[model samples]
Structures are given as C-alpha cells and as structure tokens.
Target: MRTIVITGGTDGMGAALARHFLRAGDRIVVIGRSRAKFDALLATVTSDDRSAAARAEFLAADLSLVADSRRVVEHLQAKHAWIDALVLAASFIRQHRHITAEGREASWVLFFVSKYLFVTGLAAPLCAAERPVIVNTAVPGTRADAIDFDDLEMSEGFTFARSNAQQRRANELLGILAVTDNPDLAYVTWGPTRLVRSSFAGEVGKSMKIAAAVLGTLLGQRPDVAVRPIIGIVDAPTPGRAAYRGSKELALTVGDHDDEDAARLATAVEDQLR
Candidate 1:
C-alpha cells in the first residue's frame, strides 16, 4: 500500500483526500492541531470499514511554530522509512496579522516554513520510496512580484490580501527549489480551478467571513470534487517541478522559477528558522 502523509488532513480537501486513500487501502498519516478533529476524521473513516482504521494515524502539532514543525519532522522520520506522498495542505487565511511565539508571522510559518521543513526533512524517506511525490496545495502561477524579499513576514504594511499573495508566491518558489534540489522526486504546485469550500470562515473577520460564505456558496466546489485532480497527480506524478490548476498544466514565467530567487528565499527561511 502507498503511504501518504497529509498536513491539514482533518478538513476540506485534505480530509477528502485522506478518505479517498483510506478507501483505496493506502496508509494515511494526518497531521493536524486538534485531536478532536483528528478523532472525528478517524471515526468517520472507520465507520465505513474498521480495518481501514489500522492504516490511519494522526500527529498533532501547531504548524505555525518552527519548533513544532521540527518536532513533527523528527517524529515522522522516526516512524516511516519510506513515504510515497507528502501533501502540504495546512494553511489559514488570517484577516489580521498574528505573530507566533517564535516572533514570526503566523501565515509565513504555517503556510511556507512548515512545508519547507517537511519537504527537506523527509527527503531521505521520500527518495527511498518508488515514485515519491510532493504535492503542495496552494495558489500557483501568482505573480512573483507579490513577494517582498526584504520583509517576507509582512511585518510592515500587512494586509490579508498581500499576505496571502506573498505566501502563494513563496510556495511557488518552494516547488521550484525543491525539484531542483531533489531531481528524483516530483514536486507539484496544485491549485484549485475553483475555490473549495473550507473552514476558513472561522479565521477571517466578520465582513470577510460573510463575503466568503456568499462566494463559497456560489463558486466553491465540494472538497471531494476539488481533490480529484490532486489525487490523479499524486498517483501518476511527472518528474521534476510543475504547476497545475485542476487538471490543466500552467506555464511558468521567468520569475516563477528563478533559481536565484529560490535560493535566496531558502536562505532567508533558514535564517528565520535559526
């Protein structure tokens, strides 16, 4: 059976993916912050087939903290000798700037840093597997200009839109750099063609939450529908780096895959983590 590790597997597309893999007889390890949600996911999946419960595991960590992210990496490394797929799906849309106890912006840490740690930390186990793949479920093909190298954390002039855009670009760079660093593994930036209805309403302001609810009702796809293309890619991933919106491949711009910028961002992240 294929081994899949998913961050944010308790909700939305992640949860949908977990259920799909479990039913398909794959071993699933879900990382989430809430034990209650993990238990709920386990209960829901097990209700269908008690045997599937043996293939599922959950690790709790506040991914917004660097230390927590590191601890999770260590734990997974200790437990899994070979990981077939690593899905980076954990994120939150913050209407206001929130700093972690580590003095880093919460969005940057949760969205980018934690993912970076996972990809790099689990490299050995991932490469050990046959047809290892890393899927980053984030907005791709975003303008690279959105990222401000000087203030990656958005400590100055922070806005929800700008922060979101910056994190998206950062993830794009991550896909580029990871493939360059690990040519044997596939790194894909997977973007939803349509918004997927999720629990993000709880993280935003009252006005944005109402707006999101209206938009989600009108334009969002159910988590199960949104995850179909992602599972397709995970099953038969192309080597190296690529980006897709649903099943359609996107062309990358010069800035989107800049080696210099990718290296610089990696260095900056290393410094921040240190």
Candidate 2:
C-alpha cells in the first residue's frame, strides 16, 4: 500500500484526503496539533472498515515552531523507511502579526520553514520510494511579486494579506528549488481554481471570516471535491517541478523558474533556522 503523509490532516481538505486514501487501503500518516482532532478523524472510519482505522497514524505537532517542525521530520524519518506521497497542507491564518517564542513571524515558520524542513528532511525516504511526489496546497501562480528578500519576516510593514501573499510566493519558489536538489522527486504546487470551504475560514478575523464564509458559500467546493486533482497528481506526478490550479496545468513564468532567487530564499530560510 502507498504511504501518504499529510500535515493538517485533522480537518478540512487534508482530513478528507486522508479518509479517501484510507478507504483505498493506503497507509496514512497525519501530522496536526490536536490529538483529539486526530482521534475524531480516525473515528470516522466505518465499523466495517477496520483495516482503514488500523492503517491510520497521527503525529502531534505545532508546525508554527521551528523545533516542533524539526522534531516531526526526525520522527517520520526514523519510523517510515519509504514514503510515496507527502502533502504539505498545514496552515495558520492570523489577522494580526504574531511572533513565535523563537522570535520569528508565525506564518514564516509555519507556512514556509516547516514545509522546507519536511521536504528536505524527508528527502531520503521520499526518494527511496519508486514514484515519490509532494503536493503543496498553496497559491502558487497568483503571487509572483509578493516577496521581499530584504525583509522576509515582514518586520517593517506587516499586514495579514501581505504576509499571506509572501508565503505563497515562498512556497512557489520552494517547489522550484526543491526539485533542483532531488530531480527524481516530483514537486507540485497546487492552487485551487475556486475558493474552498475549509477550517481556514475560521482562523481569520471576524470580518474576514464573515467575508470568507460568504465567498465560500458563493464559490467554493467541498474538500472531497477539491482533493481530486491533488490525488490525481499524487498517483501520477508530473516529473520535476510543476504548478497547477485545480486540474489545469500552469506554465511557470520566467520569474517563477529563477534559480538564483530560489537559491537565495533557501539560504535565507537556512539562516533563519540557525
């Protein structure tokens, strides 16, 4: 059975994807902050499908912390000899800037650093698999110009919108750069074609949450529907680096394929972790 690892698998799209794969008889490993939520997710397995429950595993972690992210990497590497798919879906949305105990912006660590750690840290096991793939659910092609290399932490002028946009750009660059290191693994950055109704709506401020709920009601797909293309890619990944919005493939702009900028961002992340 294929081994699938999903962060943020306790709820929303990640959870839906976990259930889908479990029903398909694949082994699923989910990382999230809440043991209770993890239990709730596993409890959804039908009584007749005892094997689905048996195949599910959960790792409790706060991806917002650097140490916690690293610890997760260590734990996974030790336990799983080979991983077929790694889905980076854990996310946190804050209306105001919040610094972690490690003295970095929360989104920078959670959205970008944690992803970097997981992909790079799990390189061996992922590559060990016959057809390894990573599906990062982020806005890939929408924000090519949002990043500022000088101040990645957004200390100067921090706003929730800008921070979120910057993180999306960082993730795009990550997908590009990661493949350069391990050409055998396929790294796909996927953006939803329409808004998705998920727990992400509740994480923002009241005003934005209301807006999200309205927008989601008007133009959103349920997590199960939205996860189809992601599963398709995981089953048969595009070689090297690729980006998608729903099922449609997006051509990378010249800016998106900049090795120098991608390398620079990688170095900055390494420095931040140090």
> RMSDs, each prediction?
1.4, 1.6
Tens digit of per-residue lDDT, candidate 1, span 68-114: 98999999999999999999998777888998888889988888889
TM-score of candidate 1 against the unseen true structure: 0.96
Q: Score candidate 1 by lDDT.
A: 0.87
| Model 1 pairs whose backbones collide | none
Q: Once superposed on the true structure, which residue ranges of model 1 sit more than 4 Å away at CA?
A: none
Mark the 10 consecutive residues where model 1 has the least summed lDDT.
251-260
Q: In candidate 2, what are the lDDT values of residues 163-223, reduced to their tens digit?
A: 8888888888887777776788898888888888988822577888888889988888999
Clash totals, every prediction: 0, 0
Whole-model Cα lDDT of every candidate shown, in order:
0.87, 0.86
